[model samples]
Every structure is written in structure tokens, then in C-alpha cells.
Target: MAKKPKTAITPVRSDNYPEWYQQVIKAADLAENSSVRGCMVIKPWGYGIWENIRTHFDAIIKKRGVQNAYFPLLIPKSYLEKEAEHVDGFAKECAVVTHHRLEDDGAGGLKPAGELAEPFVIRPTSETIIGESFSNWVQSYRDLPLKINQWANVMRWEMRPRLFLRTSEFLWQEGHTVHATAECAATEASEMLEIYANFAENMLALPVIMGEKTPDERFPGAKHTYTIEAMMQDGKALQAGTSHDLGQNFAIASDIKFSNQDGHVVHAHTTSWGISTRLIGGIIMAHGDDDGMIVPPKVAAQQVVIIPAVHDEADREAIMEKCLGLKLVLETISFDNIMISAVIDDRDEVTSTKSWNWIKKGIPVRVEIGKREIEGNQVFFKRRDESPREKHIMPEDEFLGSIADILLSIQNNLLERAKSYRAQKMKKIDSLDEIFNYFKSEDAGFANIPHSLWDEGLSEKMKTDFSVSPRCLPIIDGELSDRLIIARSY
Candidate 1:
């Protein structure tokens, strides 16, 4: 028998997937559990990735005529009560604040005091409060379309907290739009869903299935909900993003009525869409391997890292100078419309240690500068998408000239690999028995069945038996289809 090879992350993904995921986050130095229960403190590297996601998506939305805005983090209890269904949907997760201040107890401890007339709830979602603002701002046909987006943090009391996947408080961007006509609002919802799908595929290198949620799965008070679902390497599905067609439910609840061109007062049609930091979790599960994360080049925090390999004291100064020069040259080059970000790992450590650190960090390109390569006027590098042992040698000038193309190739390769994996894992099944049998195995993937087969009874049975649910009714070529995708999801 052969001995198993060592890996950077222990309990390889094949042996223990759930533990492997937690280990990956630690190995990558992405985030850690915070002092507050159910919350996490995102480290610099993780936050850098999020900053890139926000910057790119913000530009995309601005080009679509969406204006950025801010809203209060807390909402009055009465405000949520105006929309009954919305309140009911999030009731279990609401974190309410009853007292305004704390007073000293006799035993030198503090206790709640200054009770208020009405309690406030930290927002699980901002629909009601934003709806109130929209009501006061719109009173005529001239103010028909109000499109606003806010980048902020939201709290939802979570029972099972997973670092980036689900936490009590997380950062997100929520977009709210009010249109004069139902048709316009519906179009806005669909278009936003398309935007999310495109961002996931092109920027994140995550392939997803664009679809409409079943009625039971729709957002609270929303007539329709559209989503982009991605499958993780562990054979579970993740709802990457969602857009809601709210129709007139929220407008009616908040009295957002406007005078139309025909001199009739009517409630406005509204839509809301959002994507959160959970996307970071999706990226990890979709592209991470047993060794570590494989971040797509487009969103990698540091695209290129140059490590100086110094074997002797005499070579240290020369190698460090070469590495620093390479970093400056790499920064001048542009990739995916942004200047490349390169760093020098010139720490007082061994070359292999520095290389392994960047590999675990998932830097897209790793370049090594040693006496041999410097004297030969050559560059030696390895790509994260390939095996760790794989290496390539090229002329220094050629490497600099082709760096953009190389990054683009890495992005495209990751996307194609995810698409191929999804195709292999998905199955088309016609009967419920077959679906149940398929899920009996430990590594069952997605099952595609007829939408007509989904029902309240079947939903309960699946939840009770196999913990499966309908992911979505896939949209085919700009139209909703009857085929449904069901899977065990995160």
C-alpha cells in the first residue's frame, strides 16, 4: 500500500467535507469568530475580497440608473406591523430593543432602564422603513420611478452560525425601486436577477442556474422571486442572490400612492433585490480544493506575489532588489480593466514557507525570484488553477507582456470547470421515488424534476425524510420553464 500525500488542510475534503470547509477559512486567514455570539470578525484579506466585490457591483448598478443611498439600521415596531406578511416572515429572527439606556444597580451592576413607549427592531430587511421614505418622496407622476441602493449591515438572529455563510450581523447591499407601472417593476426585477447571474459567472467565476422560486419559497409580500442558485463541491446548493417583484403589496402597506398622468391616484409597483457576504462562502465552497482556496483572478486581492529565494547571505540583497523591481513592473500592467496588484513576500523566512502561504491565500499567480532565474533573465511562476508542483519558465519581458492574458485565462478556466462540474452532478428524474433513492447516498447532487410534481405534501415529506427542497424552476432562454431543480442546500 502507498502512503497518502500530505496536504495543507487536514482531514481532506473527501474524508470530512464540513470540517474541511472550516479548516479552509482558518488556513486562508479569512475570518474568525467574534466575541459576540453568532457574529464573525472578517480579517483584512477577506475584507479586501469583499471590497472588490462591492466596487465592481456598485459600478454595474450605477450604470443601470441606480442611485446609492443610506437608511437607518433600526426600524420602529409599528413600521414592520404595517406589512403583516413581511413581519410574519421575519418574526422569529427579529432582535428588538426595548430600553434606551442602562442604569446602575445597587450591587454595582448595570440593568436596563428608560423603557420606551414603543420598541424598535434591528432590521432583518429594510422593506418597510424604505417604503415609508418612498411614500413621502413620491406624490406625482414626475416622481414615478425612484431607484435607490444602500450598502449597510443587517442583523438577523441566527440559530446556527457559520462564519461567512450565516451570522447574526452581515454586510450587504439592498436595492429598492418604485415604478409607475406593474410591467416596469416586473422588468426591473428580472433585469436585476440577470445582473446577479452575470456578475456571479463572469466576475466570481461561479456558474449558476437562473430561475424563479416556487410560491412557498417567494419573498415575504412578494408576488414573484427570481434567484441564481449555485452548487457547491459538497453536492449542496447555495442561493447566491435574489430579486423580488413586490407588486403593490409594500406600496399599499406604506401608502405610497401617486397621481398618474390620467389624474388617478394609485399605489406604486415596487421591487427589492440584494446580495450579501454569504457570496464569499459560496466562492470558497465552489472553487476551494483540499489544498486551499482557488480565487478567480478577477477578484483576487493580490493577483501576483513574487517570492525571493535567497540561499546565501551574498544573494539576499540582489534577490530582494529583483523581487521589488518585478512588483513595480507588474503593478503598471492592467488586467480586466484594473491595474494588477502584486506583492513581494520578502519576509525573513524560507522560500517554501512564503510560497505555501500565498498558495493557501489563493493568489492567482506566484512568481519566484532566485539567483538562477535572475542570472538567466528568466521568470519562473505557477498558477493557482494548476497542480502545486506544476511550474513554467519564460523570458522576463514575455511574462510581463502576457500577464493580462494569463489572468483572463485563469478566470475563464475556473468558470468552465464549475460549469462542467454542475453538468455532471445534475440529474433529470421523473418520479419522487427515484429522487428519494438518489438522495439516499451520502454525495447526492441536484435532481431535476417536473415543476408540476412539487406540492405541499411532497415538500413536507422531503423535509422530513431527506432534507431536500426545491431550489428553483429554471428559466430557459428568457422564459420560465416547468422543470424544477431540487437539492439539499446550505
Candidate 2:
């Protein structure tokens, strides 16, 4: 038989950094540019990863008694004006629908596209609109704490969109809750922040630091904002998730209040938290390698890929039977061409090429079935991103049993690897000058600087002049350092 040449691919990290990132997204088949300039069409493979992440994170919110709901994509212009700061924060990036539709040229005559007197603005966040609903829903103390969550897409006009990192339009789940007292709202805000940290470290196998945002970094309508920041492979921090304590700003703006037991009319406190598809970007940046993407087992859509290699028809039939049988155990199973992979058993290509194919896709587990393994009544499996593939051999009957423990180990190992990197990357220092010095000296990773006073000038200056923003002003309780400001963010 004639031979086909192998396809050569460039390595990431050593390659141009941005180019490598572009290649990572493409090679992984996450998404690509659509007809629109900055918009992207998220392929199923990429959406599958998002589904895995959303499923687990959504479960966390549902477990806390937060009911799911949806709000309009476009909000009335007046709603944004309710909170002065919120409008200022999002005005520039707002995609305003000035005229819903324009008259078609004379060639086709004017088409009735649509009409609008006062065009609605696509929501950058649901705080304003959600606040309006809260005002209408709560008339008394009985409607004190109203917890609601919505899964939707939002738009932000970013100059340079990097797939999941900073896309023009992205998918995320936002939670808005109204509380009778500031204490209850604050508790809910902080609780969601912790939940985000837990999800990052455990499910996504990503390490993060939980804290409060600096003055300039606080959410537009929020009195206080909290976040979970994760450091990427390049040492840049990514704000993985955020929770904001709105206090009475939104409540007062929307006139949402309740009469207490003493007949005193009091404003409610509000909070909003969100974790977006941006997380998929973080996971790629944090856990991926030069070879390609590396997904943690818990959230990996395709946990295992089985490739059957048989010389005879009978052998192939038997192997196919075994592959079909394993479907009951795994939720997502794939048996298809590895998608342009330049490796095939029948084709004379290096086994390493085949290995790279699976690595690029970040499949958690790979099973290689061949005539030899079939004759031996066993299967040869390899764990993605794991070295020493020699340990993957098992009898067909006990294969699943033997590898169950290993799959878990891979999940745990990835989390620890990311956690240790974050701890090593964080800098705990004092003084404002020290923050800049640390960035210059240490490749500018996430800084855990402690500064006295949480004043606006100090924190706001860092944000505007420098790219650094505050992740959070963490709740220290008694151990809380005096007004110490943490400088650094995404």
C-alpha cells in the first residue's frame, strides 16, 4: 500500500503567544468567527464543554433555593437611568438600537423591518431591569428575600475579542436577589463568591483567590463587589466569577421596599452574581499545554474515546460490541474520525501523532483496541495529559473497575497542579509602590498586597492608570487587616 505524509503542527508557548492562543482555539475546535466581525459561532464541541460547566454551577445555585427566571434582552432606556453609576459604567459599551429597522433601498422598495420611538439598549447586565421587577414584586416584608437566577447571553463591545476570554457576545448565568436587610444581602453575595471559588477549584480543576474589588473595580451599581480570580499560564489573572452587594442603591432607585414589623418602610438590599462562558477560556489558559487543551475529568464532555483497531471482520465486530456495551457507563461517548487527525493504525504514521490528536481535544481517557489486545482479551487505554501510559492495560471484564479510581485521580491531580501554581504565583506585600515593583520583578501575576485604608483615591488610581483592578475586599472578620487594599485583577 502507498503511504500518506503526516501533517506537521507548530507548538504553543514557544510559538508566538497570541498566535498560539489562536491555534489553541482553532485546533481544539472551540469556535470561529461568524459573518459578524467580532461574533463567533460556538461549535457543538465547545458548547458541550460549556454545558458541562453550566450544569454543575447551575446545580450549586439551585441547591441554595434560587429559582431560575429569564429577563428581556433589551431594557427600557429609562431603567438604566435609575442608578446613576450603573448607567455610567455601561453606557459606552451599550449597543443601542437607535432605529429597529431601516427602509430598504429603492431597488426593493422600503421593507417593513421594524419601528422604534425610543430604542431599547441591549443589557450589559440585568441589574437595572431586575431591580425594576423587584420593585413591582415586593410590596411588603413577606417578599423580603427574593432570589432569582437567569441564564442568558449579554453583549459588551470589546475592541479585541479573544474567543471566550473577551467575546462581543457571550453566554452566562446571572443571579439577582433582593433582601430585607444589608446583612442578608451581603451574606448571599459572599456565599455566591465562595461557591464560585469552590466550583473553579473542584469541578473545573482551576485554582483561584477570593476577595473584594477595589473602589474602581466595584460593580457599577454595587456598594461592594466580590470576585474569584484565577491566574492563567501566562501569569495574567482572569476574573473567573463575581458577586456584588448592591446595598440600597438599586432598591432605592427602583423604589423597592417593605414595611417591617414596626411599620417602618425600609429599602431592600440587592445582589447579583455571575460566572460566564469566559470560564471555558480560563480553563483552556490555565490547564492546557503546548500540545493542546487539557480538560479536568469532572467537566470534560467526552471523558473517554474508544478507537477499535482490528485486522479481521470478526475481531472488529467483537471490539465494536464491547465499545457499545460501555455506553451505559459513560454519559458522553464518541466513536468517530478524530477529525482530520493525521494518525491512523492502517496508515503508517507515528503513534505520537495519534497521541497529539487526543491531547489537543483534551479527552480525559482514551482506549486503544487492537488485534493483540483483543487476542489477550484486554483493552489498552491512555489517560489524557498523563505520562506513563503503561498502567492502562486491563482485562475486558474488569477494565471499567480498574480505571474508575484512575479517572478520579486524574481529576484530583489536575486540581492540585493548578492550586499549587496559584499559591506560588501570588505575592503578599505591603505598600502601593511595592505592588508595581512586584509586578515588574515577578512577571506581574496576581498580587495580594495589603494597604491601609480602602479609600477611593488609592484603589481608583491603580485601576485607571495601571491595568490592575481589585478582585475583592475579603471579609476578614476579626483577623481582617486594617483597611488594607489589595492591588491586582483581570
Candidate 3:
């Protein structure tokens, strides 16, 4: 077998997967750590990609009858206490505001003042708070179904924080809905899972396995939790998205009642589902190579970058003119119904420097125009997914005509590659000892553990013994089975 070429990134993926991840973020200029502990400053380039993901996913949920709304950021401590199990689940991670003002400490510093009668907890999740609104807004069968979505920032005190994966504060979209029937709520939850899976595959170019969380892993106060799990380049699983069927737990806790068709007041069934900025982390791990991130065309900040390979100062004018013209043409091409974003790197730096810089940023395609290419009426191109050492030449007209299709191909190819990698890593194991040994291997991936092996203590033991946990249990043929998808996770 031929050895893989060395990546431009130091401490490449093969050398250290975690460090390589940080390097990729740095090389791509995506984000950075902030002065506030456990938080990050998402740079413009990073936020642009996130904005694209947000805009695309927002349309998807809206099409499914969800309407945008906003709720308070601070939840009264009593509100969280209304739901016992929910409060217990998030108590440790909740950040509380004890005072309303700051006062002089009589020294050179200031101290908290104006102590509040009731502390307000920064929302870890908004189910309880949203439930309060639902209880007040719901009055009759006419208002039985209420679906609201919020794009907001949430905070959870994390002991160990990574840039995008486990930040103290991050942005996300949460969808909450009320239904007249439990069956309808379940169906809504399932539908959202499908929507999330589709978006992950089609837009993010990530292949995910849709499944249900075990009772032990289900969201607190939720009847059931459904998730889309994807395997990353390092063979670890990442929980990409999740939807929860809250049943009547939240409705009952918040006193949300509505008149039924039969003329009796009944508690409404509710569901809450969300996808967060952690998705950015998933994208980085799932598709990024040792060189840097390979953003799918649908979610890339910039899909194409044109570089003028000016070998002679006398020819710089012509080379730059051609590059700018090609940029104009490429930007007009649309892929997946989104206009292509292209930019020309007409920097005064060396041609190799410009080419390598955009390569590190993982632009889907890079086109080089020079005097020779102009004379030949052709252009040189390179794909981010392929080795940077390799380049291809094609007629200018053909390249322009096929640009959209080429991007679509790259999107499809990334999804297929992730699917293939996951397929290679998964296996079925029946015996407990075999399951344990499977995870102990150096290159361990995912294992299908029998349902009978699960217990309340399993999660802790797996974390201690193997640094692995159950990702989800597969839902097959409209039923959830005893088989479990277990693997190490981010």
C-alpha cells in the first residue's frame, strides 16, 4: 500500500487527532478561545459557515409548520424546580444570577449587590420555561397545537470545555411544540429526527445513523429521545442532533391544559428538539483532513477561490484580468439552489503561497490562470479533497459549464466517504467479554451491543474502563430494538 502524503498541518491526524483538530481550526481561521473561561469567539469565517447552516436549517423547520419566537434568557429558579426530574438533571450545570447590581467594594474593585429574592438560572435548556408560556397560551382545542422555534444563546457551566464542542455559551435553535394527542407528539418528534438526519446528510455532507436513546440516556423528563449519530475521522461517534418526546411530563408540571373535542380539559403532550453549534465541531471532525477543513459546498463560506499564477510582472495584468473574469463567471453558477461564492486572490504574494493558503482554508475548488493557460484557452484546477500535489487542466468553457456539477459531486463524494468509513468501523458483538475487548482495541470503532447488556451502571463503567458509551439504539421498521450502537464519543 502507498503511504499517505504528509499534510501541511503539523502533528497530523495520524500523529494526534485532537491536536490536529485544533490546528485545522487555526489554519482555517474558524474560531478561538475567549477571555471568558469555557467560551469561544467565533471569528467571521466561522460564523459565516454557521450562518449558512442556520439559514438552511431554519427553512427546513419552517416548512414543517414551525414558527420563529423568542423567550426569556433567565429562568427563575422556581420555574426549573417545577419539574423535579428536569431540575435534577441540570442542577449542577446551571449558572445562577444572585444579584441585580454591582457595588463598590470600598477598595479598587466592585462586588455583587442588590441581592435578588429569587435567583435566576441561565437556561441550560428551555423546556420548563417554555412550558410556562404554553400553559398560559393554551386554552381550547382551537389552540391545541402550538409549534414555536427559537434561535438563541444558551449557557451551561462545563468543567472541561473545547472551542466549539463544549463551550460554556453557544448558539442553537430549539423547537418546542404542543399537541392534542400523545401519538401526534411522538410523530412530530420522529419527523424532526428525519429532518435533522436529512440536513446532516444533504447539506453538511455527513452520514448519520438515526436511533433512539436508551432509557438511561434519554433526556431528563422526556418520554423518549431520538438522535442522529455520526462517526468522525477518528472512529469516535458524535451526537449530531436530537429530538425529544416530552410526553405530558412538561405539560403536567407547568399546568398546560386545553379543552378537548369531547369537552374535557386534558394535559397537552409536548416535544422539544434542537441542534446546536456543536455541529460545527462535528463538521470539523467528520470531514476535515490533516490539511484542514473540507467544507461541503452547501455550507461553505466560499466555494471557490481563483488565484492568478503570475510568473512575470509584465504578464501580471493579463493574468489578473483573466482570474477576475473567471471569478465573476463562477459566482454566477449555482449549486444546490444556492448561489456560488467565489473570490479572487490577487494578492502580491508568491503564487504558491496564495494557492496553499486557500487550500488550508479548504475551499472546494481552486482555479489558477496564467499566460500559458490564457494562450491555450484552458485553466488549471485543484480539488481540496484530493492531494494538493495533483492538478488538472481543462478547457475554460468546459470548466465553467461543469462548475456547479463539480461542486455537487464533491458534496456527494464527502457524504459517501463518511458512509464508507462508518461502514468499515461497525461490527456486531453478542458476548459481554467480546464487546469489552472490541472497544479495547487500538483502532476500535462502533460496536452493536446486545440490549440485554444495558443497565443503569453501564454508562459509568464504560466511561471508566474503555472511555466509550452507547451512542444510540437503532430504530428499525418502526420499532426500536435491543441492539445498541456503542462507541467512544466526542
Candidate 4:
């Protein structure tokens, strides 16, 4: 019994987040590493969560006229060098395959052959290689809007790799498209970044600030880079995803030219947007509590866990029978297969204590079936929070409706709460000294100020002194409708 109890318990999240991270990840059965350094073996449970994200985002992308496709994993060294800036940006992080053949030495081990040809580089991003295909597929104005998205794994060899955040290899969907004109490509880039923001907010239950990346932060070959940034519990920023407008950069380099509507050959506009498995990190950091992982309702693999507390054998039989029909309506982002367990404490202690058990597991909602509610044809619902007491009972018709509404409410509240948190932490500053001062404090976010004018002189001086640059300079000039956020980013 002691052994059983030891295996069942994980640490509370209130005490420590890093320790809590280790515990919850193990308790939730997400994933862990194998023999490979900086790579993870995502358990089925973790992958199920990713599948939920992909299904939701893929549906949105499909509606926007992007079709799914597959691209090669390995790019020849020469192809990676097509766009010079891109080559320079990604060259240091690339993994190269040197030799394929191995010889059995006189000793018991096998040795790699000395003979080798040109090395192939594992792709950090598919822009250049995808550009090669675009050059061929795009010819006339008619083939101009060639939009395709691919779900694949990319290897970005990192010296220090965390599980999902900075893994050596990660899974993502990269969208590559070529348009007839630069304006359409720019629009496409912004449109996708908005989609990413919406999905982050509404579906993943994360709050984000949408902004443009400065020249220094721009994707290697991109003319302009747009990004959605999210804050974690630690007050650090995570660049959740990015969309780049290539502005004839890759098209020019790869010769992806199309005859225009005016009957003149011109470079096609190109754009690429990518969102990766690292989003799971954003979701975890944004909404997760000390309890475990507070999965946003839309992406929860098991939304509601039915924990039926039993008393007499009569109570057990009645609860088991009630749970029988529960499987029929189980198809939902929130609904898991109906579960009926008779497991009970040996001392016949109060079954109400099991509510804490479910809370510790981070189940979004727990439908409690006790004698009173079961007999009354109602079940009680419990939420995890410090706010107040909350419980409800509903008839069969209202069961699905209530759960759906509750999930949506949770999603919205999380976004609002995070937004409020960030606004309170941010202090708009006016000088370079403020930037240095803010970094020294416990408040882990931004310090430098935003300016309306693109003071080439001030920005240039600021860059040299602070080693920091403007995060976003608005393209649609305004009374600075949104002030630029200055920060040192990842």
C-alpha cells in the first residue's frame, strides 16, 4: 500500500515551477528523452495534445486555401546557399551528414569510411529548398499563387536543447507560397500571422502581442518579419511563431520569375510562416498551474474526468449503470472515453477526498457522481482555481452545452488574466539606462522605450550602446496606434 501511494503522487506545483515542470511532465505522461541528446521521444499522450493543436490549426489553414504537401528533409549544401543572407544566418546551426558507409575493422567495431563526397545538410528551415521547387512550379502569372503547407520535423542543431522549446529536432507546419505581386505576398504574410495569433489566443488559451521584427531580428532572407510573442509565467517572452514576407528575395535568388498581368517577366513575391511543437511550451507556461498542466479546453486530450465516488455495493452498481450510456456522446475536444472505476480506499474513507486527486492531475473538469447527485439525475462540476467556490448540476440535455461553455469561458478568462498580468508588469521607459536598469531587477520583462519616429540616428546609437533594437516599428503609420515594444529577444 505504501509502495502504491509512492508511485501515485507527484509534487505540488506551488512549491517550485522547475521541479513542478519535471513532475507534471512525468505525471501527465507527455514525453522524455531517449538515447539521443537534445531530442525527445514524445509519448502517445503528449502527441495526442499536439494532434489537437494540428487539427485546429490545419482546419483554419485549409479554409484559407492552403493545401497540405510534403517536402524533402535533406537539402544539398549548394541549395542551402542559394539565398546568401539565409545561408549565413542558418549555416552555423546546420547538421551535416559526412559519410554513409561503414567498414568492419579487424577489431570488433565498425569504422566510418575515409572516402566522402559533398556533404548534405539537414534543413533548419525549408525556405531555400522550397524556393527551388517554387522556381519550377511557378512560371506564368496563372501559377503564381502556389500555396502549400507541409507538416514535418526540422533539425536545428543547438548546443543547448530543452525538450520542446529548443530541441535539436522539432515538428512544425511550414507554409510556403508564391504570389504574383509583392502586395499580395505581404498581405499573405500578415494574414497568416493573424491566424497564428487567433489560434494562440482562442484555441491555445494564450495571450500574445502581434508585432513586426526589426531588421536585426528579421528572418535571414526575409525583407520584413512579423511575429507573435507570448509571455510565460516567469515573465520571459517566447516568440511563439513568425511569418516573413520575402519581397522577391528568395524569388530573385532562386529565379522564381513569372510573367506578369502586364506581359513582363518579374520576380514572384514569396512568404513563409511556421508554427512548431514548441507551442506546447507556450500553452504550458501561459495557463499551467502548480497543480500540473491546465490544458486549454480546446486542446485537452481528456477534458473531463468522471470520478464516481462509491459507498455501498448498491451505490457502486447504480453509478456503473449510469456511466454505461456516457460513451455515446463522448466525441469532443473535451470528452474522453467514459470511465467507471470501483477503486476505493481500504479504510472506506470519504470518497470526496478523490476530488483532490483529480485536481492534482490537472483535469479541467471533474464530474462528481455521489449518491445524492446520482439519484437526483445530476452531477457536480468543480473548477481548479483560487478565485472562489464553483459547482453546478445539469440535466442530460445541458451536459454537453455546459461543458462546452465552461471550456470557452476558461479559455477567455486565461487570455484576459494573462493580458492584465503583462500590462501591469510592463513599464514604458525613455532612455537606454532604463533598459539596463530593468534587466537588473526581478521583473524579467522589457525596459527600453518605444518611439514614433524611426530615428535612424537614435536607433543606430541605441543599438551600439545597449546591444538591443526595436522589436516592432509599425508599417501602417499612425499616431502610433500601438506603441513599439523594445526588448532583448530570443
lDDT of each: 0.92, 0.74, 0.90, 0.73
Sorted by lDDT (best first), the order is 1, 3, 2, 4
lDDT of 2: 0.74
Rank candidates by TM-score, best first. Answer: 1, 3, 2, 4
Per-residue lDDT of model 2, residues 152-224, tens digit only = 9998887888788888899999999999889999899988988888888888888776777766678897898
Q: Highest TM-score among the candidates is held by which one?
A: 1
Local accuracy of candidate 3 as per-residue lDDT tens digits, 184-256:
9999999899899999999998989899997777898999999999998889998989999999999999999
Candidate achieving higher lDDT, 1 or 3: 1
- Alpha-carbon RMSD of each model: 1.8, 4.9, 2.6, 4.9
lDDT of 4 by residue, 68-134 (tens): 9988898888888888999889999999987878999879999888654778898898987888888
Error of 3 at 480 (Å): 1.3
Cα lDDT of model 1 by residue, 127-238, tens digit:
9999999999999979968899999999999999998899999999999999999999999999999999999999999999999999888898999999999999878999
Best by lDDT: 1
The TM-scores, one per candidate, come to 0.98, 0.87, 0.96, 0.85
Instruction: List the lowest-lDDT window of 10 residues for candidate 3.
Output: 2-11
TM-score winner, 2 or 4: 2
Q: How far is candidate 3 from the true structure (C-alpha RMSD, Å)?
A: 2.6
| Model 4: lowest-lDDT 10 consecutive positions | 336-345
**lDDT (Cα) of model 4:** 0.73
| Candidate 1 backbone collisions, by pair | none
